[model samples]
Target: MIIFMQLRVNVTEFCIDFNCMKIPSSLLGFFNEIGAASRFVSRYFQEVVQPRYEVKQFIKQCFLIGYRSLPLIGITGFIMGLVLTMQLRPTLIAYGVVSKLPVMVSLAIVREIGPVISALIFAGKISSSMGAELGSMKVTEQIDAMEVSGTNPFKYLVVTRVLAATLMLPVLSVLSDAIGLYGSYLGVNIRDHTSLSLYFFEVFNTLKFGDVLPAIIKTFFFGFAIGIIGCYKGYNSSKGTEGVGRAANSAVVISSLMVFIIDLITVQITDVLGLN
Candidate 1:
């Protein structure tokens, strides 16, 4: 009983001291923002599974956010493969292991580089765009009008966009990996005489189901991070036009950060699973 009372006293004293201390405004704001975001995500899950699915809006978002973004992803993937191949060639040649070049480049691209780079690009483009578009709608009071009219704006706007992003990113990342491999093939031919069939033969031999699945799995997470953060930031935007700009800027930053965090988590999981 005495020990328990002493422990309670310590807790009460700590609470008193904590309340008495002057916390920095910036630190308080940071925690307040985190709490707000957590609430937003909780609301999302609650709303996502409810009835009346927005199929048409989801399709439209897929076309706009996914299909429209393909060319940029493809080009980036190609350049990534080409540059990587060129850079690795000299080192491999010096070690007299140039034969391992195709295997090395393909493993690197398919395993880590492609998914990450594509997701970063997606975050930069899609996240910022969602934030700005929704922020503007909020600023213009269109969201309020929708609510007044008994229209489900969150369902129409946030749900469809987030679902589209979650589904499309894996598809885009797979395509990027393929395109990067092709670019690597061309780069191989630039300095060395490697047949298309031979190059891919080596690449396919190096890549296995275990190697590819983890990379693809992480991309779904990356997309969710990009979509949810963007939607949350924009849906809650304030301060009119200034808030819209801040929402867009912060969405990109946060989405990009989330992608890296997810990727790191995936790597740790995969390593534990012996998929590394």
Candidate 2:
């Protein structure tokens, strides 16, 4: 009873002190923005789950957000693989494991680097685009108009973008992994002679379901996190044109951080599961 009363006193004193302290206008604005974003994200999921699936809009978003983003991801993935292989070659040669280059590079790319690099590219492109587009719509009060017209803006806008990112990222990752491996192949050939069959066979032999599944699974989470955070930032944007810029910038920053965080968690889980 005494301990409980002391705890209550501490809590009361803390609240009193907090209330008595002067909160900077900037800090208050920050809290308000965070609250708005939290509410928006919660509503976004709820709105997404309701009846009336927006299939056509979803597909359109998939094309705009996912299909359009592919070229960038592809180019980045290829360069990533090519560069990684080239950079690592000297070290492998030093170890007299130059012939093992294809296998090692392929496994490294597939297991960790490819998906991560691709996702970062996706985040830079898609998250910023989502934020700016939605933020602009918000600023123009188009989103409000939709709501007033009995259209669920969250369902129509947020769900489609998030779902598109979620669905297409896996497909993109598969392509990126394949292309990255090909780049590694070319990188291998630049300084050495290895047949396509030999290079790919080595890649496949070294790569198991263990390596593939965890990496693939983590990308889904990465995509979802990026999409949701972007949508949340945009949907909750305020202060007109300035807010749009801030939203876009914040979306990319937050989404990229979340991707790395998810990657770390994935590595831990994979290790615990003995998947790698």
Query: TM-scores, in order shown?
Result: 0.93, 0.89
**Candidate 1 residue-wise lDDT, 77-96, digit = tens:** 99999999999999999999
lDDT by residue for model 2 (1-276), tens = 334435545545555688767656575555555555556666666777788999999999989877898898898889988999999999988999888888888888888898898889999999998999999999999999999999889899999999999888887988998999999999988888889998899999888999999989988998898899898888878998999999999999999999999999999999999886
User: Which predicted model would earn the best lDDT?
Assistant: 1
Candidate 2: how large is its RMSD? 4.9
Candidate 1 deviant stretches above 4 angstroms: 1-19
Candidate 2 shows a clash count of 0
Q: List pairs with backbone clashes in candidate 1.
A: none
